[model samples]
Target: MTTILVTGGTGTLGRLVTERLRADGHEVRVLSRHSWPYAVDLREGTGLAAAVAGVDTVVHCATNPRGGDEQAARHLIEAARRAGVRHLVYISIVGVDQVPLGYYRTKLTVERLIEESGLGWTVLRTTQFHDLVLQVLQGSAKLPVMLLPAGVADQPIEAAEVATYLAELATRAPAGRVPDMGGPEVRTFPELAGAYLRASGRRRPLLNVRLAGKTYHSFRAGGHLTPERAVGKVTFEQFLTGRFPARG
Candidate 1:
């Protein structure tokens, strides 16, 4: 069995990836700031070398989009090179290169770093996760009426499905940048909010509010969507039903 190190193994997607890898009988180690077994801080380079030592593959899912994702990527790449890792798999979001968001820009920077690191690498770009969409809905639910950005479309996939795919990628030979993955269905933000409201037994009027700015324009133009590569099977409705059962 090959030894694999998963960065950010305690986070939403990272936890799923770690569980899947361990279930498949691979020797797994998790590198995170707070997780037990192997606690490594990617941003500070603490315990990273030890965590990656003797590992055959390193799956990079750790990210700090708000502040220091680039630094974390650099630290991990350097440590992996020193430990002589055979393969490095990176999980990223779709539209990072096309969108002008600060977090997206950092993700693109990390992708470039991995490409030039001289290590065997594969990058998988997936769309947003269902949990993130639900968080957005929850944030908006506090308002008197749920207001959503007009013309914004999203293709949110299940995190577990993406984790399964990431595990598959880790076991295979590095293929560089692979095809993008997205949810099976696409829907506007308002529609998704409506579904969430219905699932939670909360009825609230939804208003389509027009937004301005380049970021809004990019999102409205479908930069966050991958219709042709919608390989994920779980739909938003299914995700809501699973997470929030109908009220009795």
Candidate 2:
């Protein structure tokens, strides 16, 4: 039974990975800010060793959404190295290298750190999660109308499947930048928003705005979804139906 330490164990993916690993009869340790059986803050340099003690592998699911993700990831990678971690698995997003987004830049930097650390590592790139889709839909409902970039493409996947893939990666030898993961079908943001609205019984009108910007152009060119490596079973429609079956 390998002992695995998971950073950001309180997050959506981390929590699920921890539970799955524990159910598989592996020793699971969660590294979080608050007190737990073990507590560690990769940002504040607190309780790291205790959390990783005797762990055979480390799954890095921690990320800073507002900024500072690179520094935070660096801290965690360094700590794992110092603690003699055997393997490291990093959860990253698809199209990180293709997009110039700040968060994606940080993820790329973290991937570089893991590769340069000379440690056993695997970087799994997954598409946006289903929850993010719902959140975007809900958040945009406040405006006069939900706007979408004309011709923008997307392929969102299930968070649970990503977690399952990460858990599987945790047990395997570091594969070094595995194939990108996405849902089976590719669709547009407007379509997804419409589905979400229908699923949630919302009457918000979706307006397909022709955005003329580099970001919008990139999205329109399918920078968000990977076609060749797309390998997720749960379609966006399936996920929405599962989450909101009533379609109120």
User: Candidate 1: minimum summed lDDT over ten consecutive residues — where?
Assistant: 239-248
| Candidate 1 backbone collisions, by pair | none
- Model 2 misplacement above 4 A: none
Top candidate, metric lDDT: 1
lDDT (Cα atoms) of all candidates against the true structure: 0.92, 0.83
Backbone clashes in model 1 = 0
Estimate TM-scores for all models.
0.98, 0.94
* Model 2, CA-based lDDT: 0.83
Q: How do the residues 1-248 of candidate 1 rate in per-residue lDDT, one tens digit apiece? A: 89999999999999999999999999999888987767877788888888888999999998885788888999999999999999999999999988899999889999999999999999999999999999989988989898899989899999999999999999999999999999998898988998898889887889999988999999999998999999999999988888876541
* Candidate no. 2 TM-score: 0.94
Could you tell me the TM-score of candidate 1? Answer: 0.98
